[model samples]
Target: MEAPIKAPTPGAGGCGTVWWQSGTVYQIYPRSFQDSDGDGVGDLRGITARLDYLAWLGVDAVWISPFYRSPMADFGYDVADYCAVDPLFGTLADFDALISEAHRRKLKVILDFVPNHSSIAHPWFTESRASRMSAKRDWYIWRDPGPDGGPPNNWLSNFGGPAWTRDEATGQYYYHAFLPEQPDLNWRNPEVRAAMHDALRFWLARGVDGFRVDVIWHLIKDEGFRDNPQNPDFQPHQAGINRFHQVYSCDRPEVLDIIAGMRAVLRAYGERVLIGEIYLPIERLVTYYGPGLTGADLPFNFQLIQTPWRAEAVAALVAEYEAALPEGGWPNWVLGNHDQPRIAARVGEAQARIAAMLLLTLRGTPTLYYGDEIGLGHVPVPPERAQDPWGRNEPGHGRDPERTPMQWEDAPNAGFTAGTPWLPLTGDANRRNVDELRDDSRSILTLYRRLLSLRRDHSALSVGAWRGLALPSDLAAEVFAYERIADGETLRILLNFSNQGWSVPLDEGGPWQILLSTHSGRAGDRVERQLRLEPDEGVILGPPGR
Candidate 1:
């Protein structure tokens, strides 16, 4: 069997767990995290200014979204320079300072690595587009027009329309799984692979703990470039790109080799993480861990985000995902991200609390999106203020709603920036800001902070064995229950997925104390045997001795 990644030295009464498994990750969208210079946009230095808040929140690592040099086409996802910081976000010195402060506060730094595509402005793409004879012509995927002067075969961009855009000057069409300005790289080329791997080395040399690779599955494509078949189940409400089944375009087998290559670079720097942004079937997602376990350290399990919020549905998903995890592969969970609707908005305010409990207690590394702790819902973006190209092209499908500025306090602009904020703040700043939640024990922010603290202080919640329990045959159908145990400690987690109250008999142990409850004012209570669950509430219990 392949050896598992080495574990950090264990503490008293704690299991030996890898840093990624034992710690929580907080994702910061750099454009909205904080604005130190009052540029109305967040920067690396602004992130430095906010390190203390993360430290206070008790996350072990911070995964900041792209802050690399880009033209803001897809925000920072379109990189113009692999090794340079964008002037809009600040200089290299600023990033270094952020890293220093994060580390000093015992937090690791994970950068967003967008190797799938680089901005057309990138020197590599610039040279490739310069002339057909340019040495870097093969650096990106370029195809000649077909019989009707159309794109080669058929593939669709995630944003909208055709996957290929014609370069009139060069008489060739370049492929882009996203925006036309973001040209897909030819990972089939060894030079391209080496250079992309070098980008990892560049940041590794600068103390970046790891990378959250964007579109890792889209890095390679089928060699035949066949036209994808139409999806028979495609619905009109879904994104237009879903019209095609993506059979010939993405999630290719060769992509595993590329991810493995990136993994090798990370291995050179001990104990670092490699998080891939893969939205695929559960079985397919785990394959990124590569044969012999040498691929991405975390393939990013997002089932919870995509699965229906019903109890049976979520329970089955959790069980299937756990069963499908490859040996020694670390699991990670993401509730809401910059790409999706906020959890509170997606599952309703009541269920979001239960979702937070599930995310933390589940056996995996939990990724907390910025502002989720404060129950930030989606904020609308007016037509004129809409900056996302996705929303611009697709009309109603913009991500701006979920990418609003962090609401730190009730002051003028929610303390995110001095100037008019980039994206509108979500909810009344006075009612939803972190400053307000700090003193409200019943707030979502309090639940998140308490959950993080619980996970950090107890191995049972963080790096423990998970076992889904079957509910009583006569009990209500809207509850999910599980147990996590480690180092002689155990926690029984129960959640009522519906509005109605529920009840379950205690396990065959003794003297259990209410370690935590989603409903405020119930923790610290003792449960003799029969445990009553509050409406839409979740609870975590531990033996009195534990």
Candidate 2:
């Protein structure tokens, strides 16, 4: 068993600079962002080439997805070398140059750090599997098969398979919470904890502003190796395929200690932030911040990403999240990512724009997935062309649809590649590229830019407390209304999620100023008395001031 580390004091000041508040983060999926080497895959250099575009979008930081050295088992989530950039992406110098260029553009860079597991090809795992007496043997979870010569327990992989992989050479089974190629790291070991800590320091020393920790909750597993209880209501599509609940398998109390250790390392660097990717329910997710213990600065609020597009559902989710946050803890919002279907596809193309407005107007730091600004829909990837392991294993339903190459121009491959892209580019890429949408005032891209600029210009939208407003009965379930109050200023935001126009009821006693609107036809006379909203429209009403 790994030695236990003492937890750090909560709210300890001077742990670098925490700047996540009031910040807009743009997420970049490196493999599909841009390809500078003409290798048909996006790389660090490709991202560097687009720094000006990101800066122009008015985002405070760019959260680049995993680009670490890996065997690509689960993309870059399975880290083979924590300190180096994968050759496919570029070299260390390439990453350094990307960082320098981003900083020059006033864009902070936050890299994705996968601390939960390492690639089977990783040296640590290689040594651990060599022999039972190896020094690093305890760095991974291993056990002898049961009497029936199967895995020790009934653990299941998130990708639809047994969680244990048996090694013929060693006659032992290794634990892999995801894929067999990605083995769960034994955080129970002190050496493993120290090594992971050193990895963070390595990147911070290179001038990264922060880290987006991948699967932070899965870092430490149950030490007893007990079988997870069968989940009676388990659905095939649900992430939890195991017959049992994951109480002991994941989110262990021991994980908090590892987070504290990570925080200690980041504390050494000034102003560095850690945002964790946790897929737990709100109550459990909030615990990552520690009632009084120091852990990740932002645990990543994914409620919006997973919830349906209904108004009441979204509103209740927002309220619940805002209420569940620990005292002094900040909240974050992620609407789309590489793992899930595009919000445009989930909701409609029109509704996607409204979603963007809601995300920007909501309280907390907003993270925009790549291509979300243009309301990009999921591009279908045929079985033969699919590259995602999950997609390969489970045809037609994996994340390949969302991981297609980006649409940058009306060119052949959406300007993502000069050659055929590794994955098929969407047919709508011609219309959704940056060149076509950036200048169009009616385009979703422009709407996002304007909203972000407006949010930056107004403090009420950034750090204000959100209050939900009752919507008129005529409005569809797609419409959502809310008010943000800060410093005695109230900003009313109305979003119509439907494709049909609806007249919005106004408070007769108050005069509202139209600060912004997404509708191309709604720019005429301001709302002097009552407000009328067009189909797929969004309007921001600011209190009389300026």
In candidate 1, list every pair of residues with a backbone clash.
Answer: none
> Considering every candidate listed, which one attains the maximal TM-score?
1
Candidate 1 minimal-lDDT segment of 10 residues: 1-10
TM-scores for all predictions: 0.96, 0.94
lDDT of 2 by residue, 380-468 (tens): 77778878887666655589888888888988798898877888977777787899999998899988998999887776787776777
- Root-mean-square deviation of Cα positions for candidate 2 versus the true structure, in angstroms: 5.6
What candidate 1 gets wrong by more than 4 Å, as runs, is: 1-16, 473-476
Query: Which pairs, if any, clash in model 2?
Result: 2-188, 16-271, 17-271, 229-244, 230-243, 230-244, 231-243
Q: After superposition, how far is residue 383 of candidate 2 from its true place, in Å?
A: 1.1
Q: Best candidate, lDDT-wise?
A: 1
**Looking at model 1, how many pairs of residues clash?**
0
